[model samples]
Target: MTVNSISFPHPVLGNGDDISDGSISPEISFQISDESIRVDVTSLQTGHPDFDRMIEAGEAVWHLRVQCPRTYMREDFFESGSNKTFHLEGVDFEGLVTIEVSLVTTTTLATYRPQGLHEDYGEEKFRLGRGEVVGIGPRYQFLIDKIYDPLKAPVSSIIRIEEGEDSEGPFTVALDTDLIMIHLSKSDYKEYAGITDRVPTVIHSALVLPVLADAIRQIEDYAESTLWAARLKYLLDIRDIDTEKPLQAAQEILFSPIARTFREVNMRLDKGDD
Candidate 1:
């Protein structure tokens, strides 16, 4: 199977029939050859604020669905009558895909009822709503991520460490226990910071802090039983106390600065009290 060519529609002009007069038409085409598949999307329309407001205030949503070729079933792949699939020999199967295009237009209407004098036309609308705008950014990011890393594995799986310039084939090396320990230590600190930043201070102190404290106690017990005194000592030296204690100390350090800033702001506001 092969696609020969693709085309798109031209801009459409309206003579006061609808609000979308003189707006660009949305069109897209795809050409599939033996080597690659090429897609051409033209005149993709974007909506304005009014179109957004209308969508938000309306009940219906626009949906587009593309059907797959029937030959996809005979390509030694699974098939579903209700769903679409694409398969290529010696390549991974592609699933059903749909592309949506929207256009936005702004127009000024001439007032006929209010005499011949011209008045300021103030009509603002969004062809695409707020939700649509917010959704588009994430969708594009997802497409980029997929194109770059289709398998979607962790970074370690794809990266290769080499000795010198001429090294080629994948080389395996013994894991450095010390490096692993350091990485884990840094990861724990980042996780602690993130949780402290997001959780409410009151709840963190009353609930989360105690839970973390208990977990640290368990870790201390494990360290003692396993006779890993050196590792335990290294962990303790990093923070004069155990994990939870150091986390609490770091939180205190962060909180004090915030408190001081708040106090200064309040003092200034009090001096200008009204």
Candidate 2:
């Protein structure tokens, strides 16, 4: 008898948000025959301690059964790289997918063992083990040159595309003297091949200023003066000084009272003034 579809009695385990304490369990089903059993399993939360324990304990199991075919299997049912059989009604039994089962467990603990104390002070940690059911699908790569190459014609002085080691991929784009790099996924590179238009204004805007004023203020507060200066220089070099509104906002930050004070102090020192 050939197996049909396997029904999972419960939802697959998932990685709960509470990393400190969380657990999940999913029911797995398998289709089987008298001679062979095909089993597959997956867990949404693969890295948690609880999951690890479940695997180690062998608590997860798949129930199997064999199904009798209503008619003789057809040749078309066995497609390339597939195990499904064709039914008389033209339904593909290649739907009989195979899955491998495995168990995983993990543990975490935080403790302090003082030299004078006989007992250690500690916290117990637990996490779930996550499982993945592997499968195959399409493969592709991003060709950065196809898209960024044309961008140079419009902003060659500020943006340039460079071809790296072939292994690095089709091509890569560099903005100004800074090392800001963007990689295109293979699918996106292929989609870009059909388009002949230049980059959109919205994209250009986003590329120039991905963050807001508040974010800049936070950066200035948290980063060192040298680092902030270098970041600002990079932005100014790639951005159109006159047309980009974000540049004006950044300029205000550089000339702000706090920044002005720092510059004044440096200027005085350069003038040899005590």
Candidate 2: C-alpha RMSD to true structure equals 22.1
- lDDT per model vs. reference: 0.30, 0.30
Report the lDDT tens digits of candidate 1 across residue range 47-152: 4343344334442122222322211322222111112233233222132223332322222312211111112222422232222311110011001012222223
In terms of lDDT, the best-performing candidate is: 2
Query: For candidate 2, lDDT tens digit of each residue in 196-238?
Result: 1332332333332333233344432322222222343334344
Residue 143 Cα positional deviation in candidate 1, in Å, after optimal superposition: 24
What is the lDDT for 232 in model 1?
30
Q: Candidate 1 vs. truth: CA RMSD? A: 22.3
TM value for model 2: 0.19
Candidate 2 regions exceeding 4 Å error are: 1-177, 193-196, 206-274
Weakest ten-residue segment in model 1 by summed lDDT: 135-144
Clash total of candidate 2: 21
